[model samples]
Target chain A: MTCTAKKCGIHFQPPSIILIYEDQNQEKTRKRIMPIRNFSKFSDCSRAAEQLKNNPRHKAYLESVSLRQLQKLYSLLKGHLKGQSLAQSLEQVQREEAIDPEEDMNKLDDKELAKRKSIMDELFEKNRKKKDDPDFVYNVEVVFPQDEQVESCGWDAESDEGF
Target chain B: MAAAGGDARAELDVDVDVDAGPGQEKYDAEENVKIICLGDSAVGKSKLMERFLLDGYRPQQLSTFALTLYKHAASVDGKRVLVDFWDTAGQERFQSMHPSYYHKAHACIMVFDVQRKVTYKNLSNWYKELREFRPEIPCIVVANKIDADMKMTQKSFNFARKFNLPFYFVSAADGTNVVKLFSDAIKLAVAYKQNSGDFMDEVMRELENFDLQQKGEDFSDKEESCPEEKPPST
Candidate 1:
């Protein structure tokens, strides 16, 4: 019952997520058309992706597909509904996922902050080495490079104003 | 690849097109005409669509999106036209539909339960929202559940007359006027898409003109009048 997902794409007209997969048991390549209902340009891509992946009908086939990939597909569909071109949607997704260390996330709105946090969570999950990984090590240590001087912050400076 | 072909046709803005070759006349639709159904919850919106598209009436409730899409293939004057009938899927209970539901829509079928006077009164609000997004498309006011009271059909409804839109008294349970209502809607949608001076259509036409010029095909000669199909009497 092993299924290998080969490709995933979006259908804009009726708004469906099309998945091409190989069913090893049947030895056949099949396409699964999951109709995206109730989705609008303002829909949250991550929530939509989670729903599609957890759907009883599609859950089995989508088990091999990553949630991040599904979210990207939904994001592309959302962009198209908002009258954006394919290239524009891809660039937008890339920009959202790319984190800037200098950016102050505390200034972001709740929804924007949640989006950034989810992006960080996905990135951390991807880079994490699990116990089952070939490169897994019981104990690993690395030396810190302190070549650059640290900048002092106002909060870290002791002052008579602090209680 | 099939999905890509559908998307390409959507871009071309050719909603109804005749298939190639003589005598090979099974019309295959190249583009889709989106028709949205708006009404209050429990007003038989889904039932009417179910009755019209009797076969393959698989209604997927993607509650997250708050809409259900009913896909039906119909032929208008020998040209195959794929129609997507959008149902509210109870989104109306929240007092509004997502603006995307009206985005690029060709026509609208606003329904109300004949048994409920409140449903009838709410037509104005639904029509207002619909016009805010789509100002020029053809909209039909439907009085559904006519089977409950046939006398309702005899009673005049001023909403449709006031708006100058076509009206239909349909019964999803008995299938009265169901087929005619849907078929006529499809025709109106196709007509709107062909005649309306939408901005997207204008851009698509310019693109098509460039391709036609390179291929040496006369685009002007392809303009054919819409067939005047008589609406079957209910």
Candidate 2:
């Protein structure tokens, strides 16, 4: 029996993650309410999402659900718990996931740096084309446009020591 | 419980469908009152809630949100009131509660541990914060854990008298004045909601309308939109 996850939502009052799914075998849509337990504003969203996804009761139904989606839901819940509006939470999540090229990563603390790295990793995974993808290309090469002058970094500068 | 009888004058329209089957006896609440609890951490705010709710309680913790919502179906002056008792799930560590915690709140239960003098002193700060958000709503000052030292109740607590607010000496451990305090709170909340024509309600209503508009486009769209991209079918 195959199940396709359709939608996911959070109920702030009772603080439960509501999932709507379509069961291929029965050809019916059903809802699953997963109550979030022992979660606090300071709780880790990723860890909580992983726990929920791997729970024995939800494991079967949430097979099609992505860990990132679960994490996103948890993040929203966290924001709401911190007394932030839904829009505020969404903006925060967007800000976290987005990497600013102008921002220096060297100044970030260990925990913050790790978070940024994880965001970069997730973004990379999303954009990567797997072998099974229809549009997957092998060894595709493109010529670099030399019209614009590129700023040279110290590493890119010609090394004084010959290799 | 003496104060409970005096406020019974506020009559609410009763549901005529009392004979509507065993399982279908749904009490349609006249008002949804949000009563928030504020106090220092480990002051037994959650314990007081638990004591009040007793067997009819199903603790709904949204620790991620840093609060536990205890829903109670209360009958005040023949009117069914759905009381949402919001307990700070150790949010006191943040020094100040989130502004959203006080949003649309009809009443507040400010508690402090009797044994801890610091907790008692911190009441002024909590009261100040609460008044900043909800100035018109009824605020109750509770001296909890009286079971530890019953003698403490004899000493005059001027904090409640200073603010001219109702005071209760409650013990979550042995359930002393727990029922009275909660019931009185519900009554006060219901009364406040009915009489309140405050500007805050107007602001909340507008905010709620804005929320409704956003709910359709932003909230639902995000919820329904699948994150994983499915392969295109030929």
Off by over 4 Å in 1: A1-163, B1-30, B198-234
Show the lowest summed lDDT stretch of 10 residues, model 1 chain A.
A139-148
Off by over 4 Å in 2: A1-163, B1-30, B206-234
Q: Each model's number of backbone clashes?
A: 3, 5
**True-structure lDDT of candidate 1:** 0.69
State the lDDT at A12 in candidate 2. Answer: 84
lDDT of 2 by residue, B1-234 (tens): 012122222211122231222111111123567789998766678767876776567767877677787778788888767777888876776778876687668889999776666666677778777766566789998887666666666566666756889888777765667778888889888888788865555554554457778767545343233324211111
Please state the error at residue B173 of candidate 1 in Å: 0.6
Question: Which pairs clash in the backbone of model 2?
Answer: A39-B63, A39-B64, A40-B63, A40-B64, A81-B65
Candidate 1 i-RMS? 32.8
lDDT agreement with native, every candidate: 0.69, 0.69
lDDT of 1 by residue, A22-76 (tens): 9999989999899999999889888999999999899999998888788999999
